[model samples]
Target chain A: MRARVLVELKPGMLDPEGATVKRALKNLGFSEVEDVHVGKVVELELDSEDEEAARERVKEMCGRLLANPVIHSYEIEIG
Target chain B: MRARVLVELKPGMLDPEGATVKRALKNLGFSEVEDVHVGKVVELELDSEDEEAARERVKEMCGRLLANPVIHSYEIEIG
Candidate 1:
């Protein structure tokens, strides 16, 4: 199974990196870009029996190491 | 219009940050994890007249600011 996980800073959390990028874009003349949220995308191939089990394991992986729930949230896509 | 951009380090480019994360995962007991490729995902809501123009402008944004083409590749999804 293949899984793609997108982990992002939670709402209301301060993202200095994202803010810096957004400011850079604005200075670069992309004024149309109102906001920018930067996140991490992790592509992984796992040996799992089925989708359900894969999702469960992946969730555990995220909770344990991939993401910090106190400040981040994640979404998973499996194939 | 909405666009989702995924920017990744080009193949053969050394990703020290990603390697560090992978090592951390392994130490955390995710032994099944063989490899991990970490990339950036940027979600933007743009006000464009059409998808084509949006893509063009977004490409310019990536080229000028969002990504460094010297070591990165990006894919865009528009809706």
Candidate 2:
């Protein structure tokens, strides 16, 4: 199974990287960019065949290793 | 408009971060992890209404600032 995980900083979290990117885009003339948030996308190939189990495992992975419980929230998609 | 950009290292590019994560997962008992690739997800809010034009503009942003054309490839989705 292939799992795609998106780990994003939770709302209200301070994201210096996102702010920097937003400013850079504006300077580059993408002035329409009103807001920007940077996140992590982790694509993993797992040695699993069951879709439901793979999804569950990926979620566990997110909680334990992929995302920080304090500041990051994650969404999982298994294919 | 909201635009989502996924910037991924091109296949065959060395990804030390990904390698480190894979190793960490294996150490954490996720031995079923065969491979992993880490990428960047940039979510943006733009002051645009046309979805088609927003998509094009976002792609241009990816080409110009969000992604490195030599080692990274990007996909853009506008909503």
Candidate 3:
């Protein structure tokens, strides 16, 4: 199975990198860019054939290391 | 409008960061992790109310700065 994990900052949190990108975009003429937030996506290939097992395992991985739960939220999609 | 841009390395690309993460996971007992690839998600808020325009603009942003087309491919989702 294959898993796609998306980890994003919690609402109301500040994102320095995103701010930088927003500034750069504005300077580059994309003035309509009002806000930006940067996040991570991890794609994993697992040995399990069962989608449920793979999703559960990847969620565990996210909780353990892939995401910082204090400041971020994550979602998992398995195929 | 809002846009979510997912940028991922093209197939056959060497992802040292992913390899490092994979090794760390293995060391931490996630032995079922066959492979890992890390990517980026950039969420943007735009002034336009039109979803199509928002997606187009974000795609242009990806083409110019958010992603390296030669090594990465990006998908834009506007809502």
Candidate 4:
């Protein structure tokens, strides 16, 4: 199975890194870019016989370590 | 226009952050996860009347700031 996880800071969370990128974009002449948010993309290739089990395991992985639950939300796409 | 940019460390580039995540996954009992590579996903919502112009602008953004071209590669999905 393959999974792609996108983990992003929750709305209103302070994101200095993202802000920095936004500034850089403005400097680079992308003046129309109003906002920028940085997130993580984790692609996983797993050996699993059961799809449901894999989904559960990957969700647990995100909750436990891949993302900070308090400030981040994640979306998982399984294949 | 909307764009989703996926920037990843180039193959052979050392990724300590990704390695850390991989270790954490192993600790969480995802022993089947052999390797992990962490990447960035930047979603941009831009007001652009021209699709080609937006694509060019975003590509420049990634090249100049969003990613370190020497060690990172980016893919852009435009809508």
Native-contact fraction for each model?
0.76, 0.97, 0.96, 0.72
Query: What are the TM-scores, per candidate, against the unseen true structure?
Result: 0.89, 0.97, 0.93, 0.90
Off by over 4 Å in 1: none
lDDT of 2 by residue, B8-62 (tens): 9999999999999999999999999999999999999999988988998898888
Deviation in angstroms for B48 in model 4? Answer: 1.0
Error of 2 at A14 (Å): 0.7
lDDT of 4 by residue, A1-79 (tens): 8888899999999988889888887887788887888899998878877888888988999988898999999998888
For candidate 3, lDDT tens digit of each residue in A1-79? 7888999999988899999999999999999999999999999988888888778788889888999989999989888
For model 3, residues B1-79, the per-residue Cα lDDT tens digits are 7888999999999999899999988988999999999999998989898787777888889988999989998888878
In order of TM-score, best first, we have 2, 3, 4, 1
Model 2 chain B: weakest 10-residue lDDT segment is B56-65
Better of 1 and 2 by lDDT: 2
TM-score of 2: 0.97
Against the true structure, whose TM-score is highest? 2
Question: Which residue pairs show backbone clashes in model 2?
Answer: none
Candidate 1's TM-score: 0.89
* Runs in model 4 lying further than 4 Å from the true structure: none
Q: Tell me the DockQ of each model, to 2 decimals.
A: 0.71, 0.93, 0.87, 0.74
Question: Residue B50 error for model 1, in Å?
Answer: 1.6
lDDT of 1 at B43: 77
Order by DockQ, highest first? 2, 3, 4, 1
